[model samples]
Target chain A: MSRTNPNAIRSNRTANFLIYALCGIIAFVTVYPFLYMLSMSISSPDEVVKKTIVLLPKGLSFLSYELIVQNTQMWRAFGNSVLYTAAGTLSNIVMSLLIAYPLAKPKLVARRFFTVFLIVPMYFTGGLIPSFILMHTLGLYNNIWAVIIPSMASIWNIIIARTFIKSLPYSLQESALVDGASEFRILFQIIVPLSKPVMAVIGLYTAVGIWNDWFTALLYLPNSNLHPLQMFIARLLVFNYSSIDPGSRLKLDSAVTQTGVITQMKYSVVMVTTLPILLLYPFLQKYFVKGVMIGSLKE
Target chain B: MEQVVVQTKPKAGRIRSFLRELKRDRQLLVLMLPAVLHVLIFCYIPIYGITIAFRNYRIGDPYFALGAAARWIGVQNFLDFFKSIYFSRLVTNTLLLNVLTLVFTFWVPIAFALLLNEIASKRYKRVVQSFSYLPYFVSAVIIVSITLNILSPDGVINNAIQALGGRSTYFIGKAVYFRPIYILLNVWKTFGWNAIIYLAAIAGVQQDLYSAARVDGANRWQQMSYITLPSIMPTIILLLILNVGTLFASNTELILLIANPNNMDVSDVIGTYVYRMGVVEGRFPYATAVGFFAAVANFILLWTVNYVVRKKTDEGLW
Candidate 1:
């Protein structure tokens, strides 16, 4: 309803202004870091060393990006991250769908028992040490399987997928059953095609999770060759930055010391590791949001 | 004889029905096989492996060879942890870090969602919400790196401080700034993502109620306080309970990345301690004991909070 009274309009205007101002400030705080990092990464080493660049680039340079491109180790880690994310997400989706489809069916015997069986791990675990020990015992240590297999299924995602499947017209499955379609056939041919939205939600979740994970690599993949892009970035940005003397590294050019290049590389590495997900985020934001919404509709 | 016949008949029928159900759902069971086997190997085995806390377990020892092969220590690890010099400090640090984070960061998303709901323009609201979620998608490594860069002695914050005629402070190097920096980072990363749920809850609020409130001459603040806030209270309480349940857990990864010798006293939490002890130092049994204690504490806190919430308001995670 429209209000014509001066006081009503004045108060509404005040409230609207306050809300926009607050939200704008919050949004700026959230986004300003990425902007700063981007600007810092591209800024000249001189400006970077002087700490002159804050919100915008000065004497913009592509030197760090150039160095990062030529860095074979970073590229290898990038390749590893891609492979792990693809394998992990595929496994996650397959296993989640497999378990969720059965759980979705009311006619499936002991569905409640199976659901509880899966969910109990969410509440309690053997903690990190035992899991580490178990990994070594299973001979997954220093192997890529260590990273991909353990996180293949998440009960939360399974529940979300199951909830989506349960909401579909049961008659579709019923007719397929009458047509003598096996449960596997119905899951693959009938349920999966209709369940693309939920699959997207879970797939994106798993992909992002695998993409961002470094602790798994740190714990299990002691082999530096198997490190993901995140672990590589972490090494450059967090672990070795302070301990190792940057000046000792081979210099790219005389314009900047190894120290300055290393600083710029730190920002560049973060962008490199982060850019893929951030680039895909807008296109996939809805599915991510849908995942959360579906999860909230708890079983 | 009649009673025996009655009992035996139902038992026999139940067994037959169970077997028939199993046969009919065999395909579904087959589908569930991979996940079931995965969990048994990865999850349940580790759970059984938790028994190492009670054994005199060492690195390279046979983990599963229990009884005579692995010496039984009978809660010695637990006793050692309790009696250690670091016990009180670790407990304090973990609780303080989490409780402080909970206090400072929990209300941010709720406030953000409420304010966004108040915005008249849907387009502006959408843009603001989208920007808010950017940091949440970024890896913790990146976030910590950014934090370090901004807080470094020669970084932006210190530069600003010097420009403003103040002495530059090594923020990360000091124990005092750890909590605020961590809490701020958590708020920045989570506020937008967490707001999605509250926004969803707010969306479910009946539009008719708002219209009615308007007709009754209720102001915006009054409507929010009287109608909107109460409508989303269940969601708010449910989330709060969940947050309380995780009070014993810290952002171990972030802590590990950020903590240094300078701030170790204040920054060392149970997760970091366990990581250092078990993984780094190879004190597997000791670290496992510490982790198990934390896990039990977390479980108890979650259940207690859930129980208390259900008692008071009939809202809980369960």
Candidate 2:
């Protein structure tokens, strides 16, 4: 067919139009829930109860934010989540880098054995009951370590890091070794300095994972105070606020106002727990895609 | 004498070289200590504790301690699990839920990626792609929360229905709606994120193939089917095998959040069953046995699929 043939041009236009329409619809569907939640959270309680707020806020009010601010448990859980994400991500990066660095080296003895050792956990686990039993036996139950230690090293992350490190020129390490640098010095001073991209990828992934996790918290940490923000949000949204303290409940003069406040607060809870990651998503996206690509292209 | 010397010389040299490598890389081994210990203490120890499935384990019984109360019970726990009222229901629920979810959600990302790859405008494609990834970053709690609110009796969907002179359907409170809601939510949360891999795969397809196809009078659809799809077939097959491997492993976190008494008949799976029996009811041995059975089945399924795929085609995870 000629480049400017009318029929061909028209067909191309038709295909492009269809692609745009489908892409737009899928994007809207993906984003609609978040938009709906934001609109509901800010919309006036009366309007919310009337079911008038669908996609946009009407008679905007910050009442839910005010109530969430006053809820001490929410704040505590938020603080705990922040702490866990920070500590857990650090531990994950350290452990992953340590193992990955050694495994990346061709000179490492028993490289294949170590690779299989790490990969085995990905395919099989001891199941929930035995892990839980082990947690109690180790005195990690109801403690912060229970949240951090079990997830200290992900085999997938280690593999990603190892792949990246292997891609780095082997000559750099060789030169450093020739200059009388120890392996530890070479790894920490040379490799780690040049590994910012992989570090960022692993860091963002670990932070998001630690932030979003609630199941681990639920299993090991029976203490409500130790619960993370996601766990708190889960209790509010799923359990109907049954575990919420009575004092934290919105004290209103009428039951109607109280229920309206509670309903909006649920939306607010969802937003508060999720907004940080969503806001950081644009920056997180590149590294995450990079991480997944690296992981998928494994040797 | 010559035969003995030939065999012994290589064996001795191999051991000597291994020892030399270890001595030279002692610092690297030291660096590996933390991770090695972390795996040994956390992973392998728990693996060793799988023996609890055979014991009459209770809440405070010492793990692996051969006491009178926690003595060996052989496969009694497994037998009890097999004979239990929930045995069939749990297996059916787990398998059916996963199969339905796979059927409904698996093809979506592939279609999305194909459509996305055809877009003429790069800027618009980027914007749409960014929007699609938003839900993936959201937590399961938030996803379940949004689903519950939208499908609640007084929530938006019912409200929309009621405004249209229709009666409100208690979507969340009905057993029939659980699988649909769960599967749809999975699609919503995962489709865009999952598309990234396919998009990457699509990007790797040779531009020469498309050019040649177009030169031969192949239209856009023809090029997609003959060129793009064939190039990404390996990725598709690999992902399908991996998805099938998890046939018994339902999303326990989401299920626990959404499941209630009203929907328990449909929502109960091996995961939730183990959690309730072990953690809530303290039936450690029984729950352990049930979980072990599920894990073994999953591993076997994965192995069989991989073996068959490798035999039929040259693609396998191993």
Candidate 3:
């Protein structure tokens, strides 16, 4: 690519090396925190507080993991998170498909009105206060349905689906209609089967979103039993510090010893909550990039 | 032209055409009904929910009866919010955070995209890109927890500071450190993911332009400045214009986690403020009023900035 500029090649080579070095350092900075957190979780509680552990654990211990296992709330929150992500993503894809199919059809009547109706929510909303009141009025507050229903349909997903479906040649659907297939049959058997790629991308994206959301649980569900995994992890890390027992307090008199058990416990919890999603990340990554590219293509 | 077309058509003929199209697409329209109803109840009803900002809303009042029993005091809620002592503080803090975010965080991704584009090895580039994109998927709770661990008095960051002969301080609790820490973490979290869009734009640039520049004896930096940067300017401007709308927006979780009572003066923005007022204190009307004003300002700024960008560069989000 650079053969035309022979005289400048040497200087460009040096610049390229610098760019590689800089990006390498940035990648290190990005991954170092999680590695350190993992190291802390596995290291002995004493070593974690004394700051002896950096990239590797000084002494292995499963005490934090044992504590997490003994806690029932942790398991309950995990179940809630799984339920929300699985059910929420299914609803989102179905709802998005229903809306996107009609909007994608050129022969559909009132297309302008329907498209604008869907697009308006992207710009403005009722604001937080009124949204809360509306939820409360609907009897959704403190119910599991609160987390599921409001987020059921995403307009951006609809747009992406519409674009993907519209990109297909019109004759594909026309032939299906010529075969005496009804619109419903064509949508389910033909358009949907052909939409697997977009559907998978949107599904993975929405699942990641629902899995990581803590604010909805914080606002709608005041009951501790109903809290999601994220909310539970947040409480342990931020709000529960004062609840350490007197026996632990005696050991915490030293500056290094003060944060021994709870700090390690928090690290372990972070690993537990994020490890599943991180494991699923590589599979979703290619589709994630494709989803963004599909979104950015001009209408 | 549309009006002229409509005027030329007979009324019965226009109705007949409409009925024909509707009958042809009835199944498709029927499939859209449930989604439309969902949006109507979930999204559109919330638009009418803003009326609670004007009324003295109570918990027991039925939603529809808000107009009748919940005494309408015509902007009194808004007046109280504007007259409150924290009004300017909230406004200033919100604007300061947004401008600081734009100045510090916006360009990092563009630069990252350009640097990545310059890398010679595709394998090495993929490794670094994947690592950088990892944090954007991490939850905010986990990110803040990591920050809390690393920035603690005896944590890695302060340990390094101590090695350099500086005393350790509680970083999260300090009002002065709030903005820098917030902006820095946000930059780290978003820069890689945001760069994907710019990378896409760069990929779309015509290869012939670069070839032409190379043939003209332009060096690498010169070619980048003249060819690549000019090509991606529209994408950059479009994103910038969109970002201008969120100048008043702040992430509530990030602020809520990092802020203590000690640092509230600097860390408290409109989102967190409304959350505390409405949920914790049950001041629904007042919170609604303050939030509505902020949202209206945001919407107006979105259109105004988009209009200005369109006028100057002939590119806007219509």
C-alpha-based local distance difference test score of model 2: 0.88
Model 3 chain B lDDT-worst window of ten: B61-70
> Considering lDDT, which of the candidate structures 1 and 2 is the better prediction for this target?
2
What lDDT tens digits, residue by residue, belong to model 3 across residues B187-208?
A: 9899999999999999999999
- Identify the CAPRI category of the predicted complex in candidate 1: medium
- The 0-to-1 C-alpha lDDT of every candidate, in the order given, reads 0.87, 0.88, 0.86
TM-score of predicted model 1? 0.95
TM-score-best of 2 and 3: 2
Docking class of 2: medium
lDDT of 2 by residue, B74-182 (tens): 9999999999999999999999999999997899999999999999789999999999888888889888989988998988898899999999999988999999999
Lowest lDDT sum, 10 consecutive residues, model 1 chain A, at A241-250
- The lDDT, on a scale of 0 to 1, for candidate 3 is 0.86
**Interface RMS deviation of candidate 2:** 1.3
- Model 2 agreement with the true structure over A34-62: per-residue lDDT tens digits: 89999998987778777788888988878
Model 1 RMSD in Å is: 3.1
* Cα lDDT of model 1 by residue, A1-299, tens digit: 43657878988888788889988998898899999999988988878877788798998777778777777788899999999999989999999899889988977887668877888888888989999998888788999999988878877788899999999999999999999999999999999999999999999988998998989998998888899988887787777642223332336466454556668877888888889988898856789998887887776
- DockQ for the candidate 2 complex? 0.76
